[model samples]
Target: MSNFLSGISITLSAIALAVSGWTAYQLSQLNLLIDQQQNTITEQQNTNTQQQDKITQLTQKIEQNKALISSDTTQQLNSVSTTSKAQNNVIQPGQFVRQGFDNKIKIELQSVKRIQNPDSEEKNVVVVQMRIRRIVPKGKVDAISLNQSRGRNPETSEVYRTIQNKSTSFTYINDLPQDSWGNAYFWLKVPEGINVIDIVIPETAIFEAVPISS
Candidate 1:
């Protein structure tokens, strides 16, 4: 009976040893899997951070480009407006001319042979021998004759011409003919409130006129 009991005890000890070994092996494998999962999660987080940084940088660059384009467009528009204003400075005859405030009126005369110097304090007005340039659509000859016979307001009135008469003390000489070079004359009266004289004309309106004397 003692021999039989000893054999049974030995057999139970061997079975317990095998079970302990298997449990240790399973614990080791579980630790390895946990470590690998942690490493993968860390790597994914780093990749996401890098992608976010790149997107922020790209957005900043796009904003800067838009600002540059807006600045360039504004500068170009200002340049064009300044050039247009500079060109509007010439006055002709027989056309509706406006210069200063009050929108004064005048009659334009062409082919002026002479301008008589008036004995007045104003140095702008002078009598001139002028011919008709362009008759207004519904205007009368008597209304246009005022330009040849009488003087207009000095503040807004101006006479554009090319002939320089040094012999007489005229402010300017009228020598441009209406039919020559598709040119027309403009005459305007000075307003009651203003005390300055200036002229303005579009560059595309007329090319140049012929000599009035010839």
Candidate 2:
């Protein structure tokens, strides 16, 4: 009986040791599973953070693009407005017009002849063949004789038999030569409100200023 009791005690001890070992192996497996789960959560969180950062960057880029577009649109609008204003301020002719900048009229005289008045021996009137080269719009033109000695009516542009009637504002034109071009001369005049900065006449008239010989 004593030996049998001792054998039973040894068997019970072996069974307890087996149970403890099995429990320890199960605990280790659970710990490994928990660690895996934690790692998966950490990876998901990192992915989400990266995605948010990208979204923020994209949003900033969109805002910058919008701002640039707005600025360009504003500039284009301003340019159009300025161009429109300039066009509206333009002036036309055949009416009263003002001359801006250094505007001038040019007239060319083709055939100039000295006409001696039979009644007046000392005084002579000049006839010029003239043509219009260029004139500002709304400008007026009439024949003018270049003798201050003759009587002149500034309003009617008429000449009378007086010593002061020699000078004239009107120009005379004659037919060109047979081989020449059309026969016509020009006279230059400026309209009211427009200024005659300068008058350029061709060198076809006698007693006119001579150009430098080139």
Candidate 3:
């Protein structure tokens, strides 16, 4: 009976040893899988950071391009405006017609204004301001006539005469100063809606397409 008990004890010890070895192997495999998973997660985070940097750089470039396009558009608009103004001869600031022997007298358009009509209560008077200048001391500027026969509306063929009164500065034949630059104001009664007219600067030239201002 003692021999049988010793055999049974030895068999139980062998089974316990095999179970412990199997448990240890399973734990080692689980640890290896965890380490590989951690490496994969770290790589994914690094890729995400690089993609964010690229997105920020692209956004900065887009803003810079927008500003450049806006500046170019403004410059193009200004260029078009200046060219159109010159081509139409509207509000010519430096245009002048010269006459007299060797072109000594220069008649420049200073200002064109709309004034109230003296005879009527409406604003139907056109005021033409001319700047007459003597370029050479030897030449002469003939007496300019501001009469209905001299001023004509080419569109309507209507005549416009100067306002000649005791207080008005209407004269002939150098009765006024023939000095340097002199201001000559020509006031004429125009139609209620007439905005443009032509004037003959006697012995010089006929100024055409003169614009009227408000």
Candidate 4:
């Protein structure tokens, strides 16, 4: 009886040990599966972040494009309005127009002429002459500022400003003494085929449909 009981006890102990080893193996496999799942989740989150960044960049580019379009349209409209107003207030060449500032000073457009270049016969030059005189002797005022002189093609409505160089010329009376006369000349270059152009002195005067002749 004692021998039989020892055999049974040994068999039971072996079975218990085998069961514990199997349970440990299963637990290790479960831990490995959990680790793999966590890694997959992290990779997916990174991919989502990259996609969101791309979307943000695209949205900004779209907004910038819209703003540029709006700005360009506004500029075009303003240009057209300026061209139309100049066309309506046209003056003949060689005709004089008087302009006064605050009853203190007076200015006159004396004459305008288109002449061939003395040195370069191929290029044409437009000349404008003006005279300035003071109305008030004791009045203290700043000198008149001539900002820009521009030429516009009638057919195309293209405007050309004076180029500052040796070939182009600009002379103006900055300050005039009381009862004294001052003279100024402005010269500009024009294309050969553009015979009719509008001369514009912003906020001052417009010489409309001025003919260009040799």
Provide C-alpha RMSD values for all models, in order.
Answer: 12.2, 17.1, 6.9, 15.1
Best by TM-score: 3
- Estimate TM-scores for all models: 0.43, 0.43, 0.49, 0.43
The candidate with the higher lDDT, 1 or 2, is: 2
lDDT of each: 0.40, 0.44, 0.67, 0.67
Worst window of 10 by summed lDDT in candidate 1: 98-107
TM-score of 3: 0.49
Judged by whole-model lDDT over C-alpha atoms, candidate 3 comes out at 0.67
Compute the lDDT of residue 142 as modeled in candidate 4: 50
Better of 3 and 4 by TM-score: 3
lDDT tens digits, residue span 1-214, model 3:
8889888887777888888888888888899899999989989889998898899999999989999999999899999987775555445677645453245567777766677877779997777777666655543434454443245787877777766641124444344444766766667666667667776655666777676666
Predicted candidate 4 versus true structure: per-residue lDDT over 40-137, tens digit per residue: 99999999989999999999999999999999999999899977655543444335455555556555665555667766876667666666677775
Tens digits of per-residue lDDT, candidate 1, 119-146, equal 3443332223323233122222222112
Candidate 2: C-alpha lDDT: 0.44
Indicate the TM-score of model 2: 0.43
